[model samples]
Target: MSGLIGRLRGRGRPPFAALAAGLGLAALSLSACGGGDAPPANVVATGSAPSYYPADYAQVINASKGEGGTLTIYSNTDQENWAPIFHDFQKKYPWVKKISANNLDSDEVFQRVLSEQATSGSPADLLVSNAAQAWAEFAAKPNALMAYKSPELAKLPKFAQLLPNVYAMSVDPLSAVYNKTLIDQQPDTLQGLADLVAKDQGKYRDKITTRDVKGSFGFTVSHAFTSARPGSWAALQKILPLARPETSSGTQLEKITSGEYVAGFFISAAPAYPVAAKSGGLLKITFLKDGTVVLPRGVGIAAKAPHPATSKLFADFLMSQEGQRAVAEGGLTSYRGDVETRKDRHTYQELVSKVGESNVIFARYAEVPGAEVNAFVSRWNGLLGH
Candidate 1:
């Protein structure tokens, strides 16, 4: 039971069938690791993963030393946030040097991976992003990623099961963010917020902001609204009159932080934003009636990683309780427990507090999330009037 939840945090379960599916995946990951040879690198798009090779399996375990090469990680969260996570990771494995090669936008990371894999050379050895669903295509290919069960798997709380190879680095929950001084009352539920928006009319018409759905955080809000709406996403169209768009979560965060807007839907990737809010940083947030859409961004290693052993070692550390907690406490969502609200007036309150709780993790559903998200993004791209 203890390993059941955090281990499977991002997994969609409750139905017996879902649990069975999880066991099967775990078994698959285990079987992959048992061999010495790594799986071939073409199974990224198919349902079945490549078989693990004996030599490759041994190599991954030895990679903890960062011997042959380095681990390249990419993510959209600001560098200011990865400090603690990176620091702790380095401290854990001094030999495994992490090359924080590039900080990318959510919209661009996937395309970069595709381009890099197609021409530059190999796909990134490790990827940490809000766009894991985009990876399903790669997963179907043979030996696209190396699967391993790290020792820290026990510290993972519960959500770790859904994504056997991916570790939730931190919590980035999408919530309704408001200016504490400007808003008279915070809406606790969806209908309540809908009424508030409609009543404010002109005041909120262009004042409320969000990232365009073409990106990760933006897609989250779009998905939530669509799910909450009836018959069609058309129900959310009414809000288009009041909605304005940004290319990143940073813009919306700044608007709310500056008092330029009373409320905006925030894709809180950087915990610094929320910490700023709690520390009298002007912004405050709450899950809309449907609850905040939690994205536990994380890393996964490629099976053909030239440095497969090193990649596995790095991946293992990233999932360990220490790695998850360091990032979670730093303000991003934690996969193990609910974020311990700073309940203080301090910037980076979550980080300052050193997270002690585990939060639920969520992911972009592989089958439906990709196509479903594209449809929504295109819809917004063609919003009647931007």
Candidate 2:
């Protein structure tokens, strides 16, 4: 993906830039054809009946009709992973001319949305982020998000909803991804991995991969690990010397697939599942038998959304049963218990049953204070000799 994007930008055909340029050229051509004096085109409005809405959901569906306007979303999730959800949404409401989804880093998305809000602007009708700290920061600001309680929240677990507006779109369980061709055998537990690394430290030097703890998502996962186990930092100290640190999971997966690294730890299952499935036995995921961390990706509406009702409808759709099924089909683990996909994959409920509730460590996103993050980063940098 990075290589493709780099090639596109190198060729002076960046996706967003090309889109804007094409729009400008179309207007210019219209004016050149003696249509400059003509009035603007009229938008055709559709009936308030959305195909996916329930009988009692008519009121909200009616409210979601934005008079043929477009809905824009700012998200950290990859566009491919959420493409099905967007396609279904468009099918339900054909009146919405466009649904612009921008994929950016979690920190970039947070900063851009906040800056726009401060300037009385709205670049996105909805925001989805993996960084919990960003969500907390946005919640601190007055009217940063428009609150709306979804009726579907009742069907979801309590942990899925952070507030009336903010909800978990997906919960990704962290696992160990290994290159089967490089490693003789995969570790069944985190302790087994630590022991293997410690025994053959020189053999695996710089051949293992893990997230850089200083990054937004990295801090969230690493802090949760340390908080869950008393000796996690000690284990990390013995392992970090033999591991390469990366900020992005995609890079880690690619490196592992290419045999640059034997294995990667604390990798999110949402993105890893799709990559591993496509690798034809080269990549494999293992949930640590000792315990594993589950990270929730958040979704919420912008306060000054251009299509506020449309944003709410999209959010509701994500939490619906059909949407949850689509999420699982897209290779993301759904939090809803009822969602089950092919290949005997596990839903949140199935995972709990298999791993045991006591073995699943849910990251306390809201309780992680700023001071703890600072201290963790400082220690991590010192340990890595950065």
Candidate 3:
């Protein structure tokens, strides 16, 4: 394990402490979308777990167990959120002696993984990131990520499934979180927020908050909205001036609860849900009626992963019913229709039902062209004066 770590920790790599701090900030911001309710204790699997795997699921597991090795993963997911999933995976596959996991910023993960791949060293066996654009851009390189179509993909919503190599593990929808005490009237749609900002410009000035589009995760989301939603750029331009831009959703939520900011837009439901649920109704999350952008946590396997069999097994496990439930329990948005949670929250199906299928924009990074992304980023930088 030390040898593998040393090999990957080559020249030009930032210290783990620095990576953690950066990732901690990004994770705190991204995880701000969490739900308030605790996941049910006895989450019943939709069906037999083995059934979700391919016909040779047992063979894959057996092979992985036979060829024992450490499985290293590079991810941006919070440790608390991923602990349950990792625990379950270990319990299921005891043959794998150790699992080395590192939490880093999405950009750092991309760079480190790319460097490791280039050296033909022990790169990450598995890669998980919220930055969809990074994964999409990586997919363009031949053999950058392994291509495996899990049987569980058939069970996921069409929107959750990305390229054959990349799969959406968690579906975090962007919503509006407001301080109920400060804002008497809640806007049901983005347009409504725009109107409020325009009509009562003085009242809402410096009262709204959102991700900094210039930042990594923020750019991915803002860019997607630009490409997917018509006139969204115009809406953003009208609304951002009223918003106090911040990179961390935790910061946004804190200020909103403190009455420093009346509302926050484009907030992930993952972190916001739990905070609002526990806020004694002081904080509330609302899915925009016009449309809600679902930011999926993209999971993929490195093409040159050392523990290929184990990587495949783990990836397949993540997409299983049990894994999806763990994802929801971990406070992420579950994309599986079979999974259900507390009444206060909207299941994947409920979200689609309430918002209408057309209004739910799944940010498929693979589908977005690079030129469009550059244009959007340039415009966003100009608008934000970054």
Worst 10 residues of 2 by lDDT: 4-13
Give the per-residue lDDT of model 1 (tens digit) for 55-141: 454454454454543556544545444555555544444454444534554434445555666676664666666654544444445
Off by over 4 Å in 2: 1-56, 344-346
- Tell me the lDDT of model 1 at 124: 62
Model 1: CA > 4 A from native: 1-63, 66-69, 154-158, 161-164, 228-238, 269-275, 278-281, 337-363, 367-386
Better of 1 and 3 by lDDT: 3
Model 3: per-residue lDDT, tens digit, 1-386? 11112212211111223445454332221113232334334333321237445566667666776665568788766665665665555555545556666667665567787787567675578888776656666777788887777777777777666766888888888878988888858988888888777788778888888777656566656666666776876677778777767776777778889999999887777778778888998998888878888888888888888888889877877877767777777777777777776564346776787688888887766534546546665766565422
What is the TM-score of each predicted model, taking all chains together? 0.69, 0.82, 0.82
TM-score of 1: 0.69
- Per-candidate Cα RMSD to the true structure, in Å, reads 13.3, 8.8, 7.2
| Global CA lDDT computed for model 2 | 0.69
